[model samples]
Target: MKDTLKYMGVVVVFLLSLASCTKKWEDHFGSTSAQKTLYELISENSDFSTFTDLLNKSGYAESLKASKNYTLIIPTNEAMAAAKADYDFTDTAVVKSFVGYHIINSIYNVNTGVDTVKALNMRNKYVEFTHGEFDGVVPTQSNLIASNGIYHVVGQPLKPLQNIFNLLKSKFFSTKQVEAIASFDTVHLDGETITYHTSPIWISEVRRNMTTESRKYTYFVVDDESYEAEYAKLKPYYTTAYEEGNTTRPDSTTTFFTKKAVLRDFMVEGDLSPETLAAGVVSITGTAFQLDPADIISRTKTSNGAVYRVKHLTYKLSDQIKQIKVLGIDPRGYKQNDKRGNIFFRDKRDMNGALYQDIEIYDHKVTSFYAKYRALSMTVGKYKVYGRAIMGLAGDPQTAVFTQYVHFFDPSIVAVNEPDLYKRPVFNYLGNADTRMAFEVQPLNPNEVYLGEVTQDVYGNMQLLVMCNGTGPIILEYLRFVPIIQ
Candidate 1:
């Protein structure tokens, strides 16, 4: 019994020593890098699995594995789902090609490479590819990492060679103005046909605040018959020639101009030059230019057109200002009242940080001087201003004019307490001027922020400004408000 106990003690000591040695070895070696094989990564992670399945079907799975160095852009299931809605995911060849393009043939782990390509709408310009559940992935979402490379789950595979032009055409076909220049085979240097599509872009390039980069577009002329058809639609609305001597509508019957000169410089030429379109009333910016009257009714097509970007919504003044009855307010708590009497008689106080002083405003009085007001067309809203009036209630009445404008402002200021009182108003007292403001109202998106301002003189001349502040564009219907006068 003694001998057996002594033997047991020795065995126990030996075992303890062995365990210590094992611990020491591990400490020196640190931890073995996770031996996550590529197969396991694909099989285990749903994102990778989806991608693998796609690759397999596309016959690109083996190729992906064979490549030693590659950047794999894996879209998340959510992204894939979105893509599927718009495109066909079942096509394996398409999937493989897209994956191939995304996979740069360089063996780069998460740490080895910088995020070269960017996702569609990521707040950050780029995302890194190394380490994380979804790093180094294309769509910036769920997928897994493995020894071989990264795996990402894409909702829809991308087209390998999609260009920016085609992408834009697909995204904005409804608003694009595309004309086949070939049809206008009889092209001349003179003012022959005013392609409505070309007119807005050309005019806007000169007058509107658009970057030169946006102006770089190839304008293909449309056939004569097509030009005539489009012209017939809006020509009637255009006020005929008011240029110096050769006034009245240029014989619409003529196709080519007898003389050749620049349209902008043509105004300087002899009275023989005719102004086929209205004088002085040019589009304010690209937004207000009504090149396509049909766009107001419906959104059609998805490909091809001229592209012009503008800061404010552009449409003619006739189209921008629409007349709308004051609809009951939304219970959500934004104020849209124009009670002038209360504003004039109430104690001067600040409501939501805006000065709310009751000041008497008179119409057409000596105080109300006729300023040479210019009405730039608005693209989305129906708005009208009687005449641009400066708030001359204090020293340098024009201070408020520069500080405050009657046009649209960012929508973020809408919910914020009123920053300035009566900042945007529609001047209504200008007489014999077109009083009827008309335009389509853009439906307010729940996510989009929109704010509009209109100011009125005591005589009731008013001006309005509206803008989109939130997620989407703001559409303005007819917004006309009469000042609540005593």
Candidate 2:
């Protein structure tokens, strides 16, 4: 009977040890068998009930519950009420977007010494945490630990900033510019049945890229009144051709093309503020425009880009000259088929012992080289022409006499009466002994050497002609025409 009692005492001790271990684990973890996840922790907190409801409405509750290593910025019930006034929680897409902006995929532990921290939210936009604030929304408590992630209670709900397209739609409704742009439609005849859709296809193109793409862009938008005011300045010039049914009118100056040009000119390729935009902004059409302090109406930061509402926008005369690489120019202009007339000539006997492709203007039969530019849309002003050329052939004599001409279709004058502008005695080189040498040609007299000061008559077609006097073959390299914008 004594032995049986001792065995029973041993069994009791083992049971007591197991019970002690279970109590210790329960005290440390503060849960039954499993720890609370980020979603559950936020759901259980009374202050964050509004945020919990948002997660459920947005269909992110299950995602958060299943996800690991995340940080949730939960707003209080009062904060959510304020946000509900502005945001439509009934719209599932909007709710999803708003929730995505508050949740981050990575775990972020708050550092006491750090003043601010930037984290990328699930929406791919940045959410800044600064001094107990997450992107201007004050957080009441932070670093609430959970099994799957951490949660921070914020005083205000977070909203994702709209992209450029949406910003224009929301803010400029009264302007009618946004409505006119988005509502345009085009009809297509695919065989017999007519098919119609939106017109000005660029609107959809810009919208798609701004909303979905990761690339950034800067857009300058104006109200309908401002657009009309700007269009009035260009209407007188454009309407004349339309009335005459002039099919040959340059597309760049047409009413439709001009609108596209103006819109594209306002948009820059990157995110830029008015201060940075003043430095210089190049449009898609290769024109340059500047932003003045008075032009800015407002600026908004967006997820994919920035939008700047401007009072007025205009294209300035670009002093920037376009460079056409000599290598890319075609030499023969359908008039002659001679080897000497070729602008791009490949010579194997070059001094470097390698094949060389250089522009060769042979004087054998008045050979000519041409450079074309599309800067006739520029403001009426004198533009200076400059040239770089190699003086002589490898084994030929140096120096060559050449004449330069500036040919353009002057819209102000009748086609047959348009006068030819040329620079007489373009080059009177006093032969050099140095062979195969390169030199830059400058205008000795502004009147005698330039391509000629352009006038308002000039439109789009502008051509530069360099003719040899059959003196010798000249090696032409490149030419530049800089506008003298006063």
lDDT scores of the candidates, listed in order: 0.32, 0.57
Report lDDT (Cα) of residue 80, candidate 1.
59
Give the per-residue lDDT digits (tens) of candidate 1, residues 266-356.
1111111113122322332211232232222222211111222211112332332333332111111222333232222223222234433
Model 2 lDDT tens row, 56-89:
9987788688746789888889899888889888
Ten contiguous residues minimizing lDDT sum, candidate 2: 428-437
Superposed Cα deviation of residue 73, candidate 2 (Å): 2.2
Lowest lDDT 10-mer window, candidate 1? 258-267
How much does each candidate deviate from the true structure in C-alpha RMSD? Answer: 20.6, 13.6
Stretches of candidate 1 exceeding 4 Å from the true structure: 1-40, 44-47, 76-83, 97-145, 151-162, 168-176, 181-486
Positional deviation of 37 in candidate 2, in angstroms?
4.7
TM-score of candidate 2 relative to the true fold: 0.57
* TM-scores of the models, in the order given: 0.27, 0.57
- Candidate 2 runs further than 4 Å off: 1-37, 44-46, 66-69, 107-120, 128-132, 143-150, 176-225, 234-253, 264-385, 390-449, 453-478, 481-486
Instruction: Output the number of the TM-score-best candidate.
Output: 2
- In candidate 2, residue 273 scores what lDDT? 64
